[model samples]
Target: MQLEITGHHLEVTESMSNYIREKAERLKRHFDQVMKIHFILEVEKQRHKAEATFHVNGNHLFADAYADDMYAAIDALTDKLDRQIVKHKEKVKDHHRQEAAQLVAATETTD
Candidate 1:
């Protein structure tokens, strides 16, 4: 998956980019369908904000967090998105499994 990181008020440094990259890579463990991730980091006064937008299939999952520091903000946002990805994955897998079973039962009954 492609990861695009940008900053509004703060300079996008190598360490910042690496941190975002490292954090985003963990999402692949949840769903390999993740196509791209867009991260926007900005500092609003004393609050450091991190927002991540995950592009998967035709859907998008967005998570944002703000803290006194940028790294902490990114970490919190990553954790939030992690939970969302896991939940979505389970829902889709279960739904598809149920559909497949129903289809197999219907075909067997017809025969």
Candidate 2:
């Protein structure tokens, strides 16, 4: 997957980029259909904010976080995205199974 990181008011450092790379790899492990990810970091006074938009298969997932430190915000953002990715995976995998089962049951009852 492709990753793009942009800063709003601060310059992104090598260390921060590496940290985000590691987190993104972890996310890729959870779902392989991830196509692209765009991350935006912003600093306002004392708040550090991190937001990400994930393009997966044909759908998009988004999550944002705020913390006292940029690293902490990134961590929280990853956690939230992880949950959303897992939920999406489940929905994609199970979307048809339930309907197929219901159809089978209805046919059996009619016979």
Candidate 3:
């Protein structure tokens, strides 16, 4: 998976970049289908905002967060994305399992 981090109106320091990369990597543990992740960090007055767009398989997931600190914003953003990825994985698994069960039942009836 590819991870792209961009900053708006703020400089992305080495430590900040590394922190974001580390947190983003955790998503792979839940769902490996992630293709690419684009993160945008912005500072507006007193608010630090973080937003990310994730490309997993054929689906796109997006989440945004705001906090007084950049690190906190990034943490919130990742947590939201994590939940979405898990939900997506569950849906895919359930769909395939249901289809397979139906197929088996149909084959048994035909035989």
Candidate 4:
């Protein structure tokens, strides 16, 4: 998976970049098919915002968070993305199970 981090209206320091990368790597544990992840960090007045777009296989998942601290915002964003990835995995599993059941039923009917 590719990770791209960009900052808007703020300079992305080395420590911050490393922190983001480390947090993002955790996602791979849940879903290995992640193709690309793009993160955008922005600071507007007192709000520090973090947003990420994830490309997993053929699906796109996105989440954003706002907090008073940049690290907190990134944490929130990752948590949201993790939940979305788990949900997506469940949906895909359920879809394949449903399809297999339907196929078995059709074959039994023909037999």
Candidate 5:
């Protein structure tokens, strides 16, 4: 998956880039089909904000958090992203199950 990191109102550092890349890679342990991740980091008025968008097949998941530290915000956002990915997975699975059940029922009727 491609990971794109950008900073607004802040300078990008190697440490920050590595950290984001690590966190983004962890998503693979949950859902391996993630196509890309876009991370936006911003700081304003002593508040650090982190936003992450995950791109999947025909689905998009997003999470954001704000805290006194950028690292903390990134941590919280990753947790939120995990939950969103899980939910999306469940929804997609449910949709396919429903479709499969309908097909099975139609075949049984014809038989």
Candidate 6:
């Protein structure tokens, strides 16, 4: 997966980038099909905001968080994204299971 980090009002340092990358790896563990991820960090007055757009297959998932600290905001953002990805994975799995069950029922009825 590709990761791009952009800063709006704050300069992104090496440590900050590394921190985000490390947190982002947890997302990959949940869903390996992530195609690309774009992270936006902004500082507006006293609020530090972190936003992420995840590209997975044909779907796009977005999550954002705001806190007094940038690191905290990033942590929250990743957590939200992780939940979304897991939910998406579950939906996909259930969809295939439902389809297979319907197919089996149809074959049994015909036999």
Of candidate 5, the 10-residue stretch with the lowest lDDT total is 89-98
Global fold similarity of model 5 (TM-score):
0.83
Give RMSD to native, each candidate: 3.0, 2.7, 2.7, 3.2, 3.4, 2.6
TM-score of each: 0.84, 0.86, 0.86, 0.85, 0.83, 0.86
Error of 1 at 44 (Å): 0.3
Which one is best on lDDT?
Answer: 2
Task: Compose the digit string of candidate 6's lDDT tens values, residues 18-42.
Answer: 9999998999999899899999999
Residue 46 miss distance in model 3 (angstroms): 0.6
Candidate 5, residue 36: Cα displacement in angstroms equals 1.1
Candidate 1, residues 5-85, lDDT tens digits: the string is 989998999999988888888878879899999999999999999998999876799999999999999999999999999
Better of 5 and 6 by TM-score: 6
Please state the error at residue 26 of candidate 4 in Å: 0.6
Model 2 TM-score on a 0 to 1 scale: 0.86
Candidate 2: where are CA atoms >4 Å away? 98-111
Q: List the residue pairs that clash in candidate 6.
A: none
Judge candidate 3 against the unseen true structure and give its global Cα lDDT, from 0 to 1: 0.95
Q: Per-residue lDDT for 1-111 in model 5, tens only?
A: 888999999998999999888888777788999898999999989899999888999998888999999999999999999888888888777677889999999999999
Q: Write the per-residue lDDT of candidate 4 for residues 1-111, one digit (tens) a residue.
A: 899999999999999999998998898899999999999999999999999999999799999999999999999999999999999998877677889999999999999
In candidate 1, position 104 carries an lDDT of 100
Give lDDT tens digits, candidate 2, residues 1-111: 899999999999999999999999999998999999999999999999999999999899999999999999999999999999999998889668889999999999999
Error of 4 at 55 (Å): 0.5
